[model samples]
Target chain A: MISVLNAGNWAEQYSTIGERAFLSITMTVVGIVIVVFVLTLLTVVVSLMSRLINGKPGGKETTAPKRQPEAAAEKAAVEPAGSSAEPGASASERASETDGALIAVITAAVSLALSDSSQPSAGFKIRRIRRV
Target chain B: MNSIVDFFNAFSETINRLWQGSGFTNIQLSQIGMILIAFVLLYLAIVKKFEPLLLLPIAFGMILTNMPMAGIINMNFYDPDFITSLGYPENTIFAYREVLNEGGLLDYIYLGIKLGIYPPLIFLGIGALTDFGPLLANPRSLLLGAAAQIGIFVAFIGALLLGFTPWEAASIGIIGGADGPTAIFVTKTLAPHLLGAVAVAAYAYMALVPVIQPPIMRALTTKKERGVVMEQLRPVSSTEKIIFPIAVTILVALIIPDALTLVGMLMLGNLLRESKVCERLVKTAGNELLNIVTIFLGVSVGATATASSFLTSRTLLIIGLGVIAFGFGTAAGVLLGKLMYRLSGGKVNPLIGSAGVSAVPMAARVSQKVGSDENPSNFLLMHAMGPNVAGVIGSAVAAGILLALLR
Candidate 1:
């Protein structure tokens, strides 16, 4: 393990390092701080991206089909507790014509919403049909 | 009658000769002292449940190697012929390494500690289990993590004052990191002779964190301060989780390449965990594999703490400095937390800052527990976890820094 490089170079190496110690230490400290700062900045950006991709989607609803007026009247028919039962036939007959017209418009709007995305269109469809 | 008398005389003479020739005819006091120490460690592990996972095996190894005539870890390196003739009985031979690799029995045990392999692998297991969500939610906790590194440097200066070489001082200072793997890694690179002492000190303090940290926690903060409830952590998205380790790795590598092995492996483990695809590898790394390595690692480390090497004044100094380092580190973290609390308008609980000691989840859980005692609804676990995990990274980086500087 003989060294061909002379004693002069060894002294030179020592002298060069002595002059550069301050610079080297300062650079190291500054470099570490910058690196830490950058890493953290990157972490924040990535965190935001992941949250956006994985967050719950909002402001959407589903719509169900509307019932016909006669069907609606029939559907709400309350049976008496007694052994005998009635369909409330007189009431159904009274409202059938007007109710059927309203029901037809509601059905069109409800089906239109349902045909679109099943999410959150019901509220809009209901409002439109009620105005009609 | 004359023949019987002569035979009895001859038997007595033979017994006297045998007694004179044997080496251990009288027990030495130093051997007695070592046995007592071994018994104490054993009792502590078994009865008191003090780091029983490591202490028990270590205690057992100490007892075995300490026995006077056992040659359990003893070696005769002076004689080449004796080394050459070593092998198992001809009837049975295991697939062990060649004599050079195998060395002597004690030499083999010493390898586990010397190579610095086992502890970092343990860290990999720890990294796999650690969740960095809290860190992602509140990135400011990184400051507390950085603050805790003050203890390491403080101890380093103290070691230098005590006439230790720069490398030895660096190894001693890493005990303040309160990270066993970091301590082991640094010492392995910097001061191999002091490995046993430094490792023992780090683990001992870690086990004592419950006892050691509370007084410091209470001393540093007011009751009102401890009681403060932190704001809820915003949800950390999966994309952020994936990028966190990658970003840390690149930034850390560019700044201090020496840290890459520890930091790289650690973040890689975390990446595997958060990526959510490598469930099988994660399971193995975290549980079965970790346990197996820990046992071997603990025993091998204990075996290295032989009486001849360990019973020195330097060991005492190392232990003392280790305690000081851990205490100072806890203080720095807590003080930083207090500063953050004031800066955040009391939104942050200062107690969570103590988690920056790099004891991982235990220190974090303690912060949460202590906080909840003051305010039942207060939740600091999530907040504490950020610094806790960050401290692990910071300490590893610090260890790497010391390694590079001292080397």
Candidate 2:
């Protein structure tokens, strides 16, 4: 084990070199082990924390209420006058509301154009559009 | 005619006095060489944009310190004999009184580094900016961070073989951590004499991460492994993020109290950022406070590299060892990544392993670049961030262990 640890014969080169080489090898092995151990412990701790906080293991979807796409589309159709100055509404909420209304308007225009062309617009569904 | 002659004599005398005290006459070849090195650093910072924020100030400080008899810095503070003659024991806390009484502007600036206040404050800024979500999502990435630290010990042995004292070797070894603040913090405590060389080497190598990591990363991992795609990270809750820093601080403090100053300040900064109530403080810590400390830290650290201390063969060896340490660290992280890849049934991309050297976003970007080369659609940036941030914590832990053993 000693020879393996000092494989490069670093200890043999100098009298003072032996102690430091030994210490370095020991520290290296021990340091790597400790880091791994601590981090592993942290991993387990964090996993537990997430599980406890979210009430489920990793990757479980949250149970918070979300507005469905259909509901959003209906709201957009009914509220053609557009968003009002709602209290405590975030910028993202306002933007998303505006986006739903714009999408509804565009879909209506596309549908009207297709009906006027007198061609069947089968399997034509607008899923989403994102800026590049 | 006599009055005119007297005026001429006085003029000549004044010119002679100016020449005697001027940098032109007092400068040596060594000082000139240091000044030229400083200019090169300035060019690298300005033109190439190599870690410009810190390097620019450092290069400027080097220029200020090397000018002969400028009285910008007191080199005597670094002199051991001089420190002892001032009625204090060797290696005691820095005598700020000595610097306050006899030193100049640079000396006052250097006190931040000498008193070991700058690195932790820098860590505070880093903590505010850092996102631990990726790391939290994939806890196993922490092991890769640990594996990356093999380079530090590899260099420690190399330095020992090359005849650096244990303390000096520890300081040199930390350059492998690829963390400028950690390297500066450890070197300041262990070997202040080598602080200038170590700091420059750490930051320079960090800037060269894109150049240094790719070859080693490619050499260590197979193409198939690099092409592997990782699953997207799960969203982390704000509560988890807030608890993380506190838990880590408490654990590290209990385990290694010596690391408390660096680790504690880092966690505190992170806590402030994660808590969501201290936006003003977080903004200040992350921007204004950080900028101020970085300027003082860089210039003062650069000023320490006077001609007498910097122009030596040892500096060359340190620079060489620093590269070796960084390369070895990259290799080790990749190799461990490969191991984990096999263990996890190819879920992990080995390319992200190279990000374990604590160069933060740079190492992570290199991982992304390498992965994209193999497959253009492969987005490893967010995935690689897990190990990259973990490497920061790992290096701090390693530094604490070294300080505990060696100090």
Candidate 3:
């Protein structure tokens, strides 16, 4: 195929169609490689910065687990005894703490069920005790 | 009888002046064609609302320039060989001198574009408005951005096969970058003649991002892939944000010196926004300064589309190639995104890959929209933004490489 446009009118760098084609391919390959390399370097830069500032890869984990406020509140309510139990605590002590937490949670749920949303402070009502 | 004869002569003289001085005598078929094209652009801008900020001004400037004998813009003054053809040594100042002495209103406004001032200033505004947190939180998105630039080089090769010189090919290829300013900047530097066609193609394609990108995104990814809910991006610290601009600027300076003007301005704006100390400057850069540059840039670029220059077979080729380049770019980004998805074990949503073409929040929004279509609960906007911002840097880098090599 013939060239559609002339090379630089003054310079006439590529007079032949074959040379233009070859140069075109070469230039394209070079451009893609460099673009990818530079951007990849930036990727590394951002990742390094994230690790340096937040002490993790990509800073995916923040300093606090404040992602879900409601979930955190629920966990706090359910794991009151577990929070106090250390790794060094005895198994019997841990079991007793767990039992105490379980009773408190059940009591709280009963109170909430008996209360009205407008009157949230209405205390627990022990109308009946039926073990299922 | 003598007084009546004098009155009739005066009336005849006045009619001759009006007929000769009006545009009607000077208008050519070519100018009429360009005016019609401008009207079409106006319809698209006003009614269809396709990048109205850019299209409206460009269409108006096109009308102004295409008006026969408007004398506002003289293309010969901007032609590279025009000065030399006039038996004078060619220099930019010399050209400006000619315009200053004999040029019109637009000839002065075009100075901003010819001197390559407007694009970098526009980049600064974009930097100020941008939030790099999405990109910073997910560094891998940078790869998708880089991958999207493959479209540029691919289009370069395609343009070469179509018989354009290397410089012309490079200018055309940048349309794939889908960055309007970068395309204009490269065209002005490498192939000023094609500036009109290339700018129109780039801006038109960018505005059509939503239309051009979705089908490709759907064809490449399965419903399951599109439906994948990406993990939330980690919070980027203010410190990281501050460091990012500095790091990118330094990197561009060290690696591609030609890119310094654009990348440097971009980083400076980002730094101003991130530092929070320069709130006053950031507000101005992001809003006032940007708006000013946009008007100048769009109008002057549009004015470059004179009848002879724009009504060429080459312009048609450029428009066709521009869309092809965009498709290639979108595909490359999506493919890389799919690669990341497989590597990350289904954690990464491949749809965000389409945003790597750098239409900014629009491309990101497209990712979100497509993903939402597949899974209503999935919101991919933030995730897509990571690649979207990276695409900005990637395109600038690609432009730098092209200018350095081609020039």
Report, for every candidate in turn, its global Cα lDDT versus the true structure. Answer: 0.72, 0.86, 0.87
Q: Model 2's lDDT to the true fold?
A: 0.86
Tell me the tens digit of each residue's lDDT in model 2 across A1-132: 333333245445435756666777877787777777777777777778888897766433222123345555566667643374333334777877787887788888888898888688745766675656
Query: Candidate 1: which stretches are off by over 4 Å?
Result: A1-132, B1-28, B74-102
Task: Tell me what TM-score chain B of candidate 3 gets against the true chain B.
Answer: 0.98
- Which model is ahead, 1 or 3, in terms of TM-score? 3
Fraction of native Cα contacts reproduced by each candidate: 0.06, 0.47, 0.70
Listed in order, the DockQ scores are 0.05, 0.23, 0.35
Q: Identify the leading candidate in terms of TM-score.
A: 3
TM-score of each: 0.70, 0.84, 0.87
Residue B27 in candidate 2, Cα distance off native in Å: 0.4
Number of the top-ranking candidate, with lDDT as the measure: 3
Across residues B1-407, which tens digit of lDDT does each residue of candidate 3 receive?
99999999999999999889889998999999999999999999999999999998999899999998679899898776777777766455336678889889999999899999999999999999999998998888899999998888888888887887778988999999889999999999988989989998998999899999999999999989999987777777899999999999999999999998998999999999999999999999999999999999989999999988999999999998898889999999999999988988988899898898888888999999999999999989998999999999999999999888867
- Superposition-based RMSD of candidate 2 using all C-alpha atoms, in angstroms: 9.6
